[model samples]
Target: MSPDQAQAQGRLHDTDPVGIIDIGSNSVRLVVYERLTRSPTVLFNEKVLAGLGRGVGVTNRLADDSVERALAALRRFRFLATQAGAETLYVLATAAAREAENGPDFIREVQKITGAKVEVLSGRDEAERSAYGIISGIWRANGIAGDLGGGSLELVDVRGEEIGDGRTYPLGGLRLQDAAEDSVRKAEKIAADALDGCSLLDGGAGRAFYAIGGTWRSLARLYMFETGYPLKVMHHFAIPAGEALDFCRKVAREDLAGFEHIDVISRSRRALLPYGAAVMEQIIRRAQPTEVVMSALGVREGHLYKLLSKKERARDPLIAASEELAILRSRSPRHAGELADWTGRLFEVLEVEESADERRLRTAACLLADIGWRAHPDYRGEQSLNIIAHAAFIGIDHPGRAYLALANFYRHVGLIEEELSPWIRKLATTRLMERARILGSAFRVAYLISAAMPGVMPKTTVRRRNGELVLELPKDIADLDGERLRKRFSQLGRLMELSADVEIA
Candidate 1:
């Protein structure tokens, strides 16, 4: 059987050491997983239809009863997770929580009660994780996979099971219902345009379509019922495109009664089946895949799989990737490397002692500091911000971390855009800011060092001197640039409230 079949049939290994609690629009679910001798295995999985999305479209707040029920479920899952000895309890809140007014507050409450700090994911995160899961689990070869949920529909590009960059459109069934007609048309245009723009589908002339989520499953079920697909299983079943399109068109024109023959689609979901199927039809028309498969695993499984992977647990993936990317993509790797070496040396004497881990992250920050130049010299800084914001690096948690890293990269040019200043304050702690500052300072000095390199310059050391501070450099190094290095350190010292003096060695 195919991976999709195995997953749907619960035939694959189920031992999982990680636990994930997914607070979604329609329900709250928790899964505990451990690694078996075989593939990652699921230990326990349970779902409760808390309907956190109920009334959210109109009220813009999670219903009180829904929140209570959801929290109760989480409170129980907390025990199960702990009982299973889960070290990393990855808690994620989807559309329901992200759009609610008191979402952050409720998240804090859950953390306090369950000891699970929830990472309320944006729709993009939802799409990205789902995409990764599809790649890692079912379609490891190459194809486009999509997960259409009650809250949102996520589109992904896949190379077999390997995931590539994908985009998310906010055209979920619930959201589509709330959106204006013009808005719906605009969203369709945007989704199609984005899909067409992506290069992942370039070589996917006629690949299988791996579908996941309730909407797709429902559509596939309706097809199975109508076509009298011998078995009820949809994992590897082929729903022909013509019949699939026809079924969708028929459903689109029918009332709720037209779906009575299909029992798999619940009464609650019957009304939205037409719209959801319309989305399916839209993508299928564009993709023109040879066949379609359904996925039973998505975000929860993806979260578990990711945590088990060597990248997230054994080492930091982003730092590792950044180091390699820096060397491969930098305009002047040699110069950049030399400047980084000098910067490290200068930083040692500069009073702030960073840990090995901090230094590693800093090195990564330094290496990719020039990546922005790839886009355009004039807007390199902006490009840097975008790369950090969207790149699928190993260790990043949210866009804020990327923003923090990118902001430091821009500081290499000697100016911080004031508009981003508030975000820096809001997002970063004092320690994080200091690290960013050190990285910025190191890069700036490195740039100057490269310019004066292959020529005799000064040796420098920075340290705390008599409660104040001073950077002492060899006379030749200090004199070559005429206090250029000293002035920069002095500015940094002042900004960080440390009085600094530049003394000739």
Candidate 2:
């Protein structure tokens, strides 16, 4: 295709790039998304920690040095967003700019520099946006969502699609650090006192505590590193309440430098770790949640998600992302959709027990099955596995991500355990591993029969007969079935502990 044709095809169903310039208490960030998608893809993301809220606790004014740094960052961000083809730029300022005495001056300067109207979010607005972010990223999220920023903490109750009014506290990392005079004990007391008898957290008992913002994400990263977790994906990383409480206590009271992985964190963020941990410890103590879940989404994503139509908001992020990938990379996107239906029918005929969530994952895997077809034959599985395993996907847990990646891997490389990575295996349960194998085996058989095309797989049928799994090919395509297909079919049957045969309809 010509350059123009290629570009036109690429932008067919894609919306114009949208940019978000978030001026937070701790950092000034610029994120240009591919579009206002359910699962927005970050085309460009950059942040500068200007400590905009550093002196706000005591002086109640945005510091001069921080203001200069922030303004400089905004100027550059405006240029970068334009270069990135961002059609619209949404500028949002949180706690620092809203609370500080000199906040209005800073906002005016930002508006002038970026040539965009700045929406200084109120505490309630911040909390609501953060909650919306959790709703957008996590499927059927049920629990309390908390965003710990540099200047404040926003907490709100979330139950599926319903979100309660948000409450804000002055328990931000920088604020707490300043209030406690860098003393861990005082910080702990301050956090405890602020969150004491907070009704929002009271509703969080036995539910999830979704942690948002950079400081909390950094804290989760530390935990992930310390525990040697297999998948590095941050969203939906859950830790039990008891374990998280203990870890937070250690981080709050103990010396952070004593930890071996402390070096992994940025030096700029190291000082605030204790404060963040202290606040988290207080939250856990108060809420008694079932688990503390980390959410990478926050006010920025929430704001974007709010702009989407209600119908668009209701789409499953994982499936939408998977289908988008298939459309962009697969040989035939229609074939991928057909593959999903075909597999569903096969599972139904075979009486495979699949939960609603599992079926959703299987369908996502089907959509993504052929995404790696363009890679070299020998390395297709490895390439596809890496892409899906670490893709910027949301709404699915790590185990589901593993299933999708493994199914495609198995489709390309066959169901061979020896070739799989041990770390990836550690992420999924035994049941999921087996399901991946079965789906992979199914993909192998389906692809061999259809040649990655549409219509063929739908026409063929698989059924159980006389204690055997039989694959029936219509008379017209009977010549297409042979020893190779029979061998693949038998391999699939062996995994299910059944004999298999192929016959002409």
TM-score against native, each model: 0.52, 0.97
Computed on alpha carbons, the lDDT of every model, listed in order, comes to 0.63, 0.91
lDDT, candidate 2, equals 0.91
Best by TM-score: 2
lDDT of 2 by residue, 315-340 (tens): 99999998888888888889999999
Query: Model 1, clash count?
Result: 22
Please, what are the lDDT tens digits per residue for candidate 1 over residues 321-357?
A: 5655565566654554554565566567565687765
| lDDT leader | 2
For model 2, state the Cα shift of residue 144 in Å.
Answer: 0.5
